[model samples]
Target: MRLFHSPASPYVRKVMVTAYERGVEDQIEILGSAAGPVKRDPEIVKHNSSGKVPCALLENDTPLFDSRVICAYLDSLAGREGTVYPQGADRFDVLTLEALGDAILDACLLCRYEAVLRPESLRWDDWYAGQMAKVDSGLDDLEGKWFERISGAFHAGSIAVVCALGYLDFRFSDKDWRSTHPKLAAWFAEVSERRSMKETLPKG
Candidate 1:
């Protein structure tokens, strides 16, 4: 399989992490991409209209996109050891957490694009703050409610959460989110030590 990949994209990191966990990382080909919020990559658009990184083309050239879908597809690959996406009731909880984590990433990416991608003359401080508020609220919910669920498992939910937190540290280093969410910080600390997480650390 070939993937339109970017090292700095948390979503791509999630798919890579999943691929690693499934022991199929070596089977994939990386198609370097320069995807952006304002300007899309035409080559990536051919595979996925969103023109985003983390787009995977299977052996037959069928495209899989967005982190969640790509991760699920990778997790379901034949001959994989165990699974990152479990079966039955627990699966819903895992999926819910994944959605929450992606929501945080969405807010983080929106804030990042606003502050870094948008021109200084056109940037909106209020919009930036609004998106950051969503990130903070999402973190609060994770720390307060989903801590045990996320911390207890090694599923896609945990992958998404870690990638989201990693992106925060990578791009918003000055924010000191750990100061307020110590438990989450500690959990993130431990999960980040995994080989998959270490190897796929985001780069600009």
Candidate 2:
């Protein structure tokens, strides 16, 4: 499997974290690609069609895209030991959390693109503020569910939250989100120690 990825993408980081946790990180090769708001990377479009990062190309060249799908496919590949995603009710729980976490990432990425990718004069403060509000609310919700969701070892939900938080650290440090969500901050501190997460920490 080859992963179309970029170091700065939280979605890509989620997939990489999952792959490492499954002990199949080496089975997947990381192929650099343009991601987030970039729209004209031909090689990315050639493999992913949608030109998105965090997409996995299987040996047969079938591409699995979007972080959730790639992570699920990787989980299937790992069989029983890849219990990060459970099969039944617990699976839905993780998926739900994954969706919430990805929503946060979406807002974060959108704000980043609007500020850096778009012309400054065209930047809409209201639109960016809306995205920030989503992130703030998302963090609040996570703080409420912190203990219930983080009691276990690393899972899809846990991994998603970690990636989301890490993205904030990388891109939205000025927001000082950790200062408000102390429980989440503490949880992240502990989870950050995991070898899988430590290895996949995002770069520019």
Candidate 3:
């Protein structure tokens, strides 16, 4: 399998981290690309009509897209019946959590592109704030439930939370969200030490 990757993309990091955690990293190849909004390349569009990074090409030549789809596909490659994603209610819960986490990433990416990639005069504070609100609400929801469990069985949900927290560290370090959500912060600190996560830490 070949994964079209960019180092700075948190979504790709999520998939890569999961692959490493499930011991499938060696089965995949990373293909670096600089594609992004306003700089779309036709080659990328061939695999993903959206011309997005993090699309995967499977052995059968099928192209998988979006971070969620890629992650689910990687989970399937794990071979274990109930390891990365589990089964039944546990699986549903993790899937929902992943959904929320992906939504937060989407908002963060859009806000970033609008502010830095677009001219200042064209940036909309209201639109940006709305995205930030999603982040805020997401953190608040997690802050409440995170304390109830220190280290439950690892699932894709926890993976999503960790990735979302990492995104916060990357994009909003000045905000110091950890200070307010000590439990979640501690949880993230614990998970960060894992080799899968350590190896995939964002660079550049």
lDDT of candidates 1 onward, in order: 0.90, 0.84, 0.81
* TM-scores of the candidates in the order shown: 0.96, 0.94, 0.93
Expressed as tens digits, the lDDT of each residue in 1-204 for candidate 3 is 899998888888988888988888998898988788998867788889888978999878699988888878888888876567777666677777778778878888888887789999899999999998998888877878644432576677777778878887887777778878777788789889999889988876
Which residue pairs in model 2 clash with each other?
A: none
Off by over 4 Å in 1: 78-81
lDDT of 2 by residue, 10-111 (tens): 989999888888887888887877664556568878777777787788878887898999988888888986578877768788778888889999898899
Top model number, lDDT: 1
Q: What TM-score does model 2 achieve against the real structure?
A: 0.94
Give model 1's TM-score versus the native structure: 0.96
lDDT of 2: 0.84
Can you give the lDDT of residue 27 in candidate 2?
88
Runs with alpha carbons beyond 4 Å of true place in candidate 3 = 146-151
Which pairs, if any, clash in model 1? none
